[model samples]
Target: MSTNRQLVSVDYEIFGNVQGVCFRMYTEDHGKKLGVVGWVMNTREGSVKGQVQGPADKVDEMKQWLRTTGSPSSRIDRAEFSNQRDVPDLELRGFSTRYH
Candidate 1:
């Protein structure tokens, strides 16, 4: 039988008018629906930061959704993605708004 390995982590910095909108909530909803495990939050720099761990294909799908149709009221200026192998486990029970 084949072993099921945990997928690598993907860190993304989504810029543009991601703040003041329901970007985080949308992202969380979409991510969870896509079977991704992570948390999304607004940074102090008016950007949204999120890390998703799942199969590579699913992660790519999540990224695309975030860039295109996730935030209807926001414009996605930039989306930077990177592979992270050492990210700690996260307990993303629900979507939350963080003030920093």
Candidate 2:
């Protein structure tokens, strides 16, 4: 069996009731737990946006989590994923929440 794993990167923006709901915190925790590296931040437009990169399966799992589940008080109306591509290796070191 092949020991090498395929990696992928994706950009996502989540809409609806995401801001001020601990969404970025949960996202960072979940991404780390899933062994993925990424960053999440809140937008001024009242949404969440970030980029994730990791093994293909792990990335997929993270995507699902972003789409369906977030912080307890969060209401995820929709999630839009974009800029997906295959990468030779992980670009980021760890998951985190960005503040601006």
Candidate 3:
């Protein structure tokens, strides 16, 4: 990390028992509840990948939710987050799921 500034958006890859669970749906719902915009999708590697954008603090809270409250059937091992800054413009309109 070069500079420490407010992060407007973030990218994440959630690992462990994250697949085969309705993680994407829960994530989308949670993001909307937190007033964030992003997309979550199932990766071929049995992981979940997504990006969330909003106020810095809300984004952090959303990240925490992703790391903790995955679907009831899912066990979240960890959520690796990045791109903590450098978002000049919010790209996502609303939280959604991408099928791949």
Candidate 4:
């Protein structure tokens, strides 16, 4: 029996007409469907900040989808990722609109 789990954390900033176009909503919906756990919000600087954590491969797939198909009529400037050691232990129930 093997009990090894692989998890990863991804942070991305999507830009260019992303706000007001239902980008966050779309991201949240898709992320949930992909079994991702994290938050997505619009930054004051006209960008979307998102953090997703899950299986390594699933996380990567979600990132790719966000960069390509997940973007709703918006231009994705960049998507960055890093290996995180300390991740919060919380379950993402659903995606919401955040004003900040």
Give me the candidate number with maximum lDDT: 2
lDDT of 1 by residue, 1-100 (tens): 2222445577788989888778888888888788878778888888899778765567778878877776778888888887666334443544444456
Candidate 3 lands at a TM-score of 0.88
Off by over 4 Å in 3: 1-7
Per-residue C-alpha lDDT of model 4 across residues 12-33, encoded as one tens digit per residue: 7776778777888888888788
- Candidate 3, 20-77: lDDT as tens digits: 7888888999999988889999999999998998878788888888888889999888
Scored by Cα lDDT, where does model 4 land? 0.70
Please list all clashing residue pairs in model 2, or write none if there are none. Answer: none
lDDT score of model 2? 0.94
Worst 10 residues of 3 by lDDT: 1-10
- Tens-place lDDT per residue, model 2, 14-55, is 999998888999999999999999999998999999999998
Model 1: colliding residue pairs: none
* Candidate 3 lDDT for residue 83: 78
Better of 3 and 4 by lDDT: 3
TM-score of each: 0.78, 0.95, 0.88, 0.76
